[model samples]
Target: MTLSAAGLGSTTQPLSTVYDLAMLDLDGVVYVGRDAVPGAVKALTEARTNGMRLSYVTNNAARTPHEVAEHLRELAMPEVDDGDVVTSAQAVAHLVADAVPTGSPVLLVGGDGLRGPLEERGLRCVTSLADEPVAVVQGFHPDVGWRQLSEASFAIQAGLPWFASNTDLTIPTARGIAPGNGSLVQTIRNATGASPVVAGKPQKALFDETMERVGGRHPLVVGDRLDTDIDGAINAGTDSLAVLTGVSTLQEIIERAPGQRPTFVSADLAGLNESHLEVELDGDRARCGAATAVVRETVVSLETGEPAGTEALRAVVGLAWSVRDRSDASLTVDGTLGA
Candidate 1:
């Protein structure tokens, strides 16, 4: 469904009470690298106490659910258990099993993350096409090298179906961003001129898996990235909240593309228990709480009675996005959004 001129949405009640479950993106939403995002643990605990079930979702296919849960526990999130985590590996495994017969040998190009789930589906994992494998599954693993990719290419050339856990081009690390599964998938795609069926974020497979694991009457997708987490929610036909603790910036969200906008915006996880201010649309102005934003000609201006905060930013996004949608007006927002 298309968002109205006002954009995604607004809510009077706290999100924790309104939604039964929260499908959260792990890397950016919960923790950065090794530490929890500021206020994340406390906010999540409060959300759970308020009756919201938290489900950790990720496109990273290298680690198993238990490993991810352990990492969360290390970050002081004791509430996260193996059952509370959903991985793209699990999604791709089901996708592969549905196509191929159960107990069929599938060529595996990933690590234990892919092997464990495929085994659970009764599919045998093989290293080579010589095993007479019926299909191939690829995911991100540090050990995946030329040999694995060559075997996958051979299988695909022999008409074996191919599936991928995710197509994310980059994975963030302590040093910097590194090549992710998508970059490796691109190599195979370029060589064989064929693409694998992807089953991750920005796709419906991962979301479906999350919903199946955690029952949600009205699930709210909580995340930090606009491209994956927020867009995934749009694809799944669910509402999403974008927090500022990770990769996305206020300006980036203000100029969000179609099908990539979020229903709510907050400084951090604290938003789960707080009411989201509504962006009220006027003739040419959008107002939220005490802040108003208007676009005249090629300039977007922000006017606020109080100091600007997350709610004020939402007003600016509503006005800026609406103006950009209607015309080629340039957005002049240099001094509007504070640091």
Candidate 2:
């Protein structure tokens, strides 16, 4: 696959045939909340059958890996175990373990997700600063509140080593979008005027951790979010696929700078088994398969053909980015996505 700005790659073989391992992100990529996305089980099962090692790597530090595996199994996914899953909790724990004394007491601001990994790494978990903790580590949990943040604030204010699983400002819930661990971390940061060493997405640590554990020669980072999942892959210099089953939209992705874009795009996990069509660019136009996109002044139009939706989007995105790279003119591709 050619790696370049606005260079959506094409392959004669399926992605499962190209990559040895798949580093998956939870939430929008696999399951949202307590349920699995439609056809997720089937798609993943097929990818596994195609000899691609599937590793669930997530920034969500709320649940233990076992809990995540259990949830996946309950949703009728393949026989997934805790070892097959990696969390930001584990990533942060590794960072903390490398820096601090073994068996040291750490002020844990989250739940057992943080506690389990810390203890596994020979670190101790404590709730209060009165415990004489050596460091403060935080993650996200629904139950985290003022008291925990207060303890973290106290510890951080006093110059204790602080580490955080991630800095995602918001997380999606069954109800709606809500504050994530990063949001709470911001509260403590504001109070203490300190920043914790982050180990999650957009940081290279978590992906590196996944690589160490999963042991893949060629890995594909797959997720729905641009900021964390796709951008994290870019940060790690890894190939990524942005699926539309979750938060980000086609329109939003096409407008980003080249370095921030994913290597591939698909409507869902089902795209894993399909041959990708490359977006070919002409003067002021882009084409993918039967779909064509042309720039008419400041507005970009995706002219529909046999296979429109995503193909047209690929063309439009290529054209939009090509235009962006040449001039500072803004593109308007608002209503062309559904075409």
Candidate 3:
């Protein structure tokens, strides 16, 4: 399962030459809150300048595509169009619109950002408990209260379908942290003993939508969380790179499942420029700089069930080893490896 540079049709150019597109995670990969990560803008500009197509994918159910683009522009990362952004709210809206009857009344327990998508689909948004809702759609709302949860709980008990933009329990914010949609969804779930359909990262629907929006090419999914970004990449059959600037920690990356492991890992965007790997005809090899051993061991553990002990564990270590080895191998593109 090793992806060689030649197999990717890059023997003369650099490994970056083989990747046609990059799917970037907004919150942690590019910027945190309002401040851009160090060298994030430079890395993005360089990638774009080098001719790589870029798309920003997020699980934030609070922002619309337009709002996301505005945030990116404000952060001075890279100018991205609405078409290049995807949000859980948009995905959930599509799900609701397709499944539920058109113009059905929906009990929205979120903000205007999340409600906008459903409204755009012609769904009636209702806040009153007296209104009969066909479904309960939950998203991020700072003003969430017990009253809203009780209303949603009653709706679910009355046989209304429950849907959540994302089940993320915690959301990153400028004011430390706050409960995510997952927490709110959990309250309702616990109260009504109901389950919610999640429409965010790690869900195949959002990934499919993203791929379709990006024209379905071999793209690299970059993010900070292993559960969401890396898992989404696995579900989408794409490569992923994990950065340490967000929710995922070094220990977590080391313990990720093989299918959920990232193809590349870096401290931040700053080190990504120097990050290089060779995708040979046989397999991929990564160059060791700082976290090479950790990446290698993690990949090995993922590929094979063997522990990260000194002994090389066996099992389906082929793809995992190849991925680990090529993390810094010299890839050949069109008979020439890029400098």
Candidate 4:
């Protein structure tokens, strides 16, 4: 893969008018824990008025689509509906159903979310290997204990088809980051010495299902994560917007690997309505808007600009990424730009 990180193409029109559909990541892009990210509800409402259909695509399989939509509704997001939400549970359940016969017994190691989808696909959820299960589907649930994992391991050791709702290593909670499904999946993998087919972000199944459900001819993936949301957009051959209201940071963007860079970067969802300025490269200097950044060897210097704003950071990121890409060298921010 050609790792071109700088000088990504520019957009003349606002993204809301350019894309027919917006596949939004729920956790970071829309909300964090139980609260809406600042300005998310308002921005989404305006984007809808601008004629962009928004679909919430999530890797969290603990909650059903209805539950997620209800949470969004509680957050003042009235446009969200059960149908507009797609979960990893639905994707893994579909994967298992297609491989097994209709109404076949399948072992479940997760919660109601995982069971709901499997049952909807006419697959029976069995807990034990003695049930003659043809497959095993595991996800993350607080109630999922060692017993469930042991049973899943037994079934997997027998060569049953293994599937996972999502492999997100860490999940953000009101209490802070906690172990997610990927961390739990490692338990069974260590025990049975087997890996599972994942059906979440960074995988194409969830994106494909979201597109099919929302019917977006031109879809823009809006997310706050680089590894999953942004990389998943690249995997699906779609454009993406990276929001800084979540896990990713300016440092991460400065050294983004191939397929990890987003088409646009913004402080919040309000960027949907604004046009992005292209980064202009002049020799070793990169400029965007009123900000200018110069990269000398592996070091980057922000001479004068809005150090804390998006436009200046965009220019600096362009120069930093370009320098790293050309020489395969690391980038060091000169620390002139204040936080």
Query: Please, what is the TM-score per model?
Result: 0.91, 0.95, 0.78, 0.93
Best model per TM-score: 2
lDDT of each: 0.84, 0.85, 0.66, 0.83
Give candidate 1 regions above 4 Å deviation. Answer: 1-5, 257-259, 282-285, 294-302, 305-308, 335-339
How are the candidates ranked when ordered by TM-score, highest leading?
2, 4, 1, 3
Clashing pairs in 4: none
Question: In candidate 4, which residue ranges exceed 4 Å CA deviation?
Answer: 1-7, 296-301, 334-339
Q: What overall lDDT, based on C-alpha atoms, would model 4 receive against the true structure? A: 0.83
- What is candidate 3's CA lDDT for residue 166? 83
Q: What would you estimate as the lDDT of candidate 1?
A: 0.84
Cα deviation of 246, candidate 3, in Å: 0.6
**Per-residue alpha-carbon lDDT of candidate 2 for residues 87-140, written as tens digits (9 for 90 to 100):** 999999999999999999999999988899999999999998899999999999
Per-residue alpha-carbon lDDT of candidate 4 for residues 107-190, written as tens digits (9 for 90 to 100): 999999888988999999989999999999987788999899999999999999899988888887767778889999999989
For candidate 3, the clash count comes to 27
* lDDT against true structure, model 3: 0.66
